[model samples]
Target: MNTKKHWAVVVGLGLLTLSACGSSGGASATGSKTVTLVSHDSWAVSKNVLADFEKQSGYKVHVLKDGDAGQAVNKAILTKDNPQGDVFFGVDNTLLSRALDNGLFQSYEAKGSDLVKPEFRVDQTKHRVTPIDSGDICVNYDKAYFSKHGLTPPQSFDDLVKPEYKNLLVTENAATSSPGLGFLLATAAQYGDGGTSRSSEAESGGGWQAYWTKLKANGVKVVDGWEQAYNQEFSGSAGGKKAKADRPLVVSYASSPPAEVIYADPKPTTAPTGTSYGTCFRQIEYAGLLSNARNTKGGKAFIDFLLTKEFQEDMPLNMYVYPVREGARVPAEFEKYGKQAPHPETMAPTKIAANRDQWVKSWTSLVLK
Candidate 1:
């Protein structure tokens, strides 16, 4: 969900009014009719769909596009006492605990909570956040690069450490990017926490830390965020093509191939990129009413509107994420090119929260050093 910013084509939606502001600015004044929504840069909605919400609810929506998901969440936490907007969106499962621990949101059960898929729901008792969309953070390969090199793209995490695939992969910094953290968590899930009780040949007896060490040895490149990894380093993306990027593999979304196809000029008959489904981690994004919001009522209404069928159905192209609402229809391109991973690696939020900080510290020492 964080790297959804890679789909740059959908970002220019003229109908939705936006304010490019940081968390410290652009907050709505008290008693104002405008309800501001602060989110990561990828947020988008069709003009008519957003118009429908405003016309029906009589509350004008003003969106503030913060940086990426990680940056936005950190900024929101710093400003929780005086938030930038009424509602905050783009906090994903990877960072949900941080926001919750800091008391960034006030609980409010959305109107159509029952419609959300059961698997995506979390914090059921508190209702501090509402599940909005889900996607898989995965490794994407350049089709042409593999074909031209007579190289079979790496399929799984283990394959990456093999000699043949060395120097062909790039990923974001785990401490600063959602997809990067997801990939790190995926390895931690695949190989247990290096405890003696879970020793196995697949884990190489040292667990995720060992895995990352091997990945670093294999020449995996690390960038600051998804945009740099996908658009500037990955060979298959549209931005990468213009930039003449050389890395054939990048950590991005399963939905990336469809976005490539859909945005190409003369739309390709088939996607130029493909996902390595084996190297995927599930990611779920959420939205909530910011604590100390000026327009509590408007914030509640907007959160409810997000669960509506119209908004859910409009998400695929706009945000490149799957709606969490059951029975929501995805675009044809998504179905054909970006089917969800059958068994994406996942870790419980509790496990992630308990170990995330240490893992990042270890990762920085092992990989970035």
Candidate 2:
């Protein structure tokens, strides 16, 4: 999951107006002691934890938030020759191949590479990027809405297309949002690209495309990004509750439920939302030293700091993501309300790289039309 999807709502409405921490350009123009980090809008850290990194590395951190994950990665690629910053963060598994294929990053394995969980590691031969955090993209339901209507919240992909759930779902655009793309990939993984197998009542012989046809027919709604879908359309989020959003089901991160509990005004005894685990897709986010960074040393050091225990443990509360570091402790709210799915849908990066664009194009034509 991209933290950009939930950080604003999780932390406070004040975070919604967050801007670039410092001016643009590399360390050479600013100063040798300055390190610039280019990332999506969700980048966050506790002041003390970051102060520790600054003290240990002797580099003042400057942050530049480009936009959502897809927009940020595309912008970084366009500016790769004279990149906006020394390091780039917030690129995820969905867009990893595009970043690597564009030669956006240089090879530099961080200091604590061994501490990262093995499953999260990629580009093993090149060390082009370091895995930072991970989460699951899944469908979430408004518990109160379901209970009030005497309806059981959907538990699986098959359940989403049933008549009872019609016109009740909302999702982000697959071509624009990371979680939206992750959800698209989840269906692709569940129903093979062109396989004729009918795995369930919701599945068709035509594979994922046919599944989308059913989803679209069920009156699924599409929005441009996660914030709009979750905050303005889905009824489960605190923002949605205030907005009086009607859709009860939304494509969001599995960790969203805990955020609802942790950030509520009165702080509910239990999460107000729930995840449909069967629809989950594993998402991993990474950071790397820009190919022509002016502050290579500072960038590498910052990447190393990301894997430290202190930084890893601070991530859940700040960014609403699971650290890739093996021993990182998750917040109690996450443990009690938002456990990761036991069997999230997954696909190899190589497979995603080969098919992602075509799938998105086809999905756009099938569902968005």
Candidate 3:
């Protein structure tokens, strides 16, 4: 959910081009049959998933878990001239345009690409990336804490800026976290401060910056990334126990409460928390063959495997994300507790790509500074 990583693409592309081109890192295979898949830390698969892929495709699979979506994509781009891995996964809609524009992928046209649902199939023109999963970034509130304080959960973006909610919210920095960027985008769309035309200044005009100014005055706590905001600060999550953070509101996924149940110490009969549907921000993840792969054939095969029923079916419970492939079964935990918004805010990839950097800049000035 860290869309903030894309800002690096805007400023670091030139350096990446030069540095990557000068290296021969991924040109030769270290092991004849081994094919590496580079992905973000959040990516997860069943224990034997790669082994199954290896058995089916006759290729040894190595997964390199990078820092986050933005970091992974940026690393891929920086190494595009000589890719360190054969395939790259975890570039979401927010970071998709930057990855595509940087020419980080090679056209593979994996056979199972058609199996993806129409709503999730984002890359039609170029066969560079294939949709694999989707999720909703939303604000999750501490059910127990809110009830204890006799305070109602915020119902909308407007409610967040109210005096009653002061010091009760914590969000990741838009410059470093994907969900942070997502929540910022939701506010931008809600306030008419998004898109390329708007300036990133509070005094210069009314837009995302102005909205952020009001949020800052409401005593919002801004952290570096989702891990800190959700795990260290949000009172609802067990992770908050580590830091004793009592902030009841945080930016997380709609499916997070269900995930907590699924991964609980003693599996819970029901979810212990809930998410605010009003804050949902749709994020779609994609995978593609990195250009100049040492094992292009294996890379294409891996992408095909990703879209197959086997991999898709393993996604929901393991990764806490919805599979993009049609006919993939949804886990019962998801059906029971995962919240979905009736109408989550959305912005075109083009507009987001064009305005993302400026919006983050404005948000930082208004909120962080």
Candidate 4:
């Protein structure tokens, strides 16, 4: 939430809007070949990276910024029969099943798909989507606030519900936010939810759902989305510079600290915040060709470009995500201040796909009721 001025400048690129309705079946508005990428609003890359793609592929790239991850996916599904963009980017593993179930994407394995780490790969056999970059959702605490109050920062998910920590934590609602859903899955992984055999009934009074009940009782605050939870509620976020939030801890990314240092007004000598990785959730974002794309050849080329060293390396400072390509170099800021959770919690895409809706429903009933 406490984004640097430069980061604000990065997102200042106005959202691109296209008149065409389907992925590639018709000629472009200008009657030229083009690859239109429909992605969440958080997407950013230097102009040069895009220019390079255009130079090599000879197809103009048009990026249409939908809202958040959920909003983007919903739009894609709504436009499925006709299609709105050539490729869909930003569907993380948590929402991968939703896209797959709707038949929104066609398989196109990138040449570089094999370069990705095994853990980051979600759709292996089908190759419906290619892994691009990853981000982790974890609890971030205000160093100044914790130090001022002489309270030790929370180290684990279990620590957040302690009496001393009550009312000090804030997070987005799982039903409404990507980070929220990842956190929900993290809890499920940590506490166990009967491991695929047990039905939703087994989850109600035990495992992750039971943990949510405890968190609700402990006075944890929930917001509608990440911007509200991080910027308006978390004491350590950029909004705190002008108007501080009441809560000192918030659900945010491990890369947030590096972002803070990189974007600081006076350039902080050290990071002003720290992350709690005890139960962090790893979220791998992906790119895929739309099933109805008119330019299937162009879509394949664009998806392949996404997994290349050039595109993957541009991600760190520009978008603040780890490159799925193993040897890609990260910015010095990330090397110094970023926290890569050594043992982040993860679940299989199949299992997550099967249980996601039910898990979200049960979570809502327990925590938001």
Candidate 5:
């Protein structure tokens, strides 16, 4: 070969060698597909369930636990061009519109979307993502406090503002926390309506504004996150933690009841904590695939795993969220601590999506009083 041709041949051989080595390296190592699952903190499922997935699929499921759902989504969006995880979960209905708009999911229906709550099928893709579990953020009052103080549990969103309830409530900040936003949305849903068409009306009149003004006068307090509000403020059988000053009422999930019971050493036959009547707020959670995922197969598999009976039954005690499956088992503690509200109000996903950030921003300003 001429000198130029010899040089070209040598370069071609080097390229071929690199390609074969890369392919062989992938094939030889682990004999497994690594699926990265990015989810919010405290979203742990049953260990056996995940183990089963990793076992059956020959895919090692790597869970990348992040902070809040919003933060997780932000990270996913920033990496959308390159992509990181195979699936993303814990984007609730309140945050669904943003995830969808950002094109974070590739759609595929699960094996049993039919098993999901009928109302949850708002968007359908080949099962790109599916509903797993949900929780309600409600005013969790210490039964002991209310009874001892000779006060009644708060009945309406407006009731939190009453004189007797003064300075007892502590809640998450809506701007930073999912549960905080859930509480805010619950108030918006209960008094007015929260959908796309109507502007959220919170004037000095008879509504959320009026409710908040009363709560302010009643000595309502705000916290940076739910952990502070629950683990610190809410008095439960999980009672080793000291209550923060002026924090008798907390905003927490309904599933907290069961968790308090099961996790307590010497597992209480009955829940150690009691709930407020008609004081609960509802917040439905959701799961979705990343807009750009490297392993769509693993993404769908993970979601499918969540909806299974094993995962569903274990959810209440483990994660403190109600499984979307109609007949999932709930822990006794959850039944005790978590309340199925006498009259739970809900905001549609679309309405929540539209007004969420705006509502949070507005509430931060409004509640500064």
Candidate 6:
């Protein structure tokens, strides 16, 4: 991949760490004391966060910005034998299977990982891929649009395709967008008979296909990326013009609501937008130690540190991603600006690992072509 028609930024942010590891390959310490963190561009936080971790632990940190989720894992696998970075962060459920099956991660669960939400915490293969944080990808409608039009947001996948919203909604292509893929998986979960991912063997694949056809028939303006789909396609931009600020409704992570407020210019005391529609798809993200790591002990500590309260709480505000911790408090902007997706879509990593390429290719040929 060229990412052929995908929301490059969403895929970049969502799967950032999964892209590649070993950027500064083999920059490990002589003894078992230092650690190299081959982080993705999406693997970010206040610089102080990393510094605090380093101070607590004597391990010297070597950090590098690799590519996105898939690329990071790809490089990790390629360099498995030589073992470039000690630890990798933010390889989510979508790429989990490939990361694990390729034998890229070493087994080491974090401390107090047992208290994490069961689904988010477990790496069944015993590979111990630690769940760092999780969030939902759902349909977000501008509150202004719904209120102004005297209409309610779509409650289900089918609601989106109804006549009222024929030209109002915008979505990214699946092959190129992580949010689009998340939306697709949600339909599979709803229609695909409760399966999270649509495999060839999955009966839900038909249901997923049916829903997509209906959505297509409803007249969605398909775009290649989330930025175009959200910032430009949806109505309710300050100008509300497609070319000017077209995207109002989009496929995005649940954390976006808070992100909007957090990232807003000059730092607003309150949020500027509202995500009143809770049409979200739950997505769980994980971190794994490259199968061949330069410093195994250091890798384990870094993963554990990611789960700590400081990191978990800092996640929502800094990275605009939710924390995996059971009782994390959301920022004011997140609670007010962000809304939840009640019925999120899901897919097991294994299923996605098997069919992602084929499905993406078919989708490209069928629709994007």
Q: What does the lDDT read for residue 251 in candidate 1?
A: 91
Candidate 3 similarity to native, TM-score: 0.88
Q: Candidate 4 — worst ten consecutive residues by lDDT sum?
A: 8-17
Best by TM-score: 2
lDDT for model 4 comes to: 0.79
TM per prediction = 0.91, 0.93, 0.88, 0.89, 0.82, 0.84
Go through the candidates in order and give each one's C-alpha lDDT.
0.85, 0.85, 0.76, 0.79, 0.63, 0.65
Candidate 4, superposed: residue stretches over 4 Å from native? 1-32, 194-205
Model 5: CA > 4 A from native: 1-32, 125-128, 193-206, 235-246, 266-270, 336-339
Residue range 141-210, candidate 4, lDDT tens digits: 9999999999999988888878889899888888887788888999888777734412242334478867
Give a tens-digit lDDT track for model 5, residues 1-369: 121111000000000111111111121132227777776665665678778878887788777755456766666665666555667777777777777777777777777678887865667645545887766666666656667778776755656766767777887777776667777777776565322322233443355645666667678778777666676666642542454334667777555555655566787676554555455555566666676566777777777877888888876655667777877777655555565665666777788778776776678898863
Q: What is the lDDT of candidate 1?
A: 0.85
Q: Write the residue-wise lDDT of candidate 2 on 29-128 in tens digits.
A: 7567899998877889999999999998899999887766776777778778877889999888877888899999999999999999999999989999
Better of 2 and 3 by TM-score: 2
Q: What clash pairs does model 2 have? A: none
Residue 25 CA error for candidate 2 (Å)?
3.9
RMSD over all Cα atoms, model 4: 4.8
Model 4 TM-score, 2 decimals: 0.89
Tell how far residue 91 is off in model 5, in angstroms. Answer: 0.4
Task: Write candidate 6's Cα lDDT for 1-369 as tens digits.
Answer: 121122122354233334333444365543577787765556666678878998999887776556655566667677777766778776777777777777877777678687677767567568558888777777666666677779876765666767887766677777666677766656656666334433442334455665566667777667765666765665643223436654456676665555655544566665444543435667777777776676888888888888888888877665567777888776777677765555566677877778776766666565555
For residue 51, what is the lDDT in candidate 3? 73
